[model samples]
Target: MANTAFMKPRAVSDALSAIVGKGPMPRTQVTKKLWDYIKKNKMQNPKNKRNIIPDEKLAKVLGSKKEISMFEMTKKVSNHLS
Candidate 1:
């Protein structure tokens, strides 16, 4: 059975919304949209694909760090979801 928790819609912060779009959206959808933006912009680090090079809009969502891992991205993104 699918985990309903991940499918429940949640409020998204302004910063996150810039990357994932304005939402009351599910975490699954948020992740999907986020990945779509990332790939579209080619944000992944060349030598280290696990690292995401957050752009200006993404920087607001993930902070102004130089880079962050996919795992860290997930963790930080959750903070923007309520």
Candidate 2:
């Protein structure tokens, strides 16, 4: 069975909403959308595939961090969801 908490829809913060849009969506969906935006904008670091270089919009969601790992991405994004 899937974890209920992970699947539960949560409200997205304004910064994140700008990237994924405003809505109550599951955490998995939110992550998927976030990746979609990252790929669409070619934000992944060429030297290191695990690292993501946030664009102007993503920078807002990721705070002031210049670059972040894929694992860290999920952790940081969780902060923007309630």
Candidate 3:
């Protein structure tokens, strides 16, 4: 069976809400919103798409990292979700 854990709604933190919007939303939706925000803001590194260079607002959710990998992004984001 497919894992449904990611589909379960979770409480979103204030920091995360700034990026993903108000949530009580599923992880999938949060990730989708994050991606939409990133794309809309053109945050992906030109040299390496795997790395994201976040803007001020995104930096808050990402803990102000200079750069972060796509894989690490999920991990970081998870911290902001309960």
On lDDT, the candidate that comes out on top is 1
Candidate 2 regions exceeding 4 Å error are: none
Q: Write the per-residue lDDT of candidate 1 for residues 1-82, one digit (tens) a residue.
A: 9999999999999999988889999999999999999999999999999999998999898887579999999999999999
**Superposing all C-alpha atoms, what RMSD in Å does each candidate have to the true structure?**
0.8, 0.9, 0.9
For model 2, what is the alpha-carbon lDDT of residue 69?
A: 96
Q: Which pairs clash inside model 1?
A: none
Candidate 2 residue lDDT tens string, 1-82: 9999989999999999999988699998899999999999999999998999998888888886599998988888989999
In model 3, residue pairs whose N, Cα or C atoms come closer than 3 Å (at least 3 residues apart or on different chains), thus clashing, are: none
TM-score of 3: 0.94
Q: Between 1 and 2, whose lDDT is larger? A: 1
The whole-model lDDT of each prediction reads: 0.94, 0.91, 0.91
For candidate 2, the lDDT comes to 0.91
User: Which number leads on TM-score?
Assistant: 1
Q: For candidate 2, report its TM-score.
A: 0.94
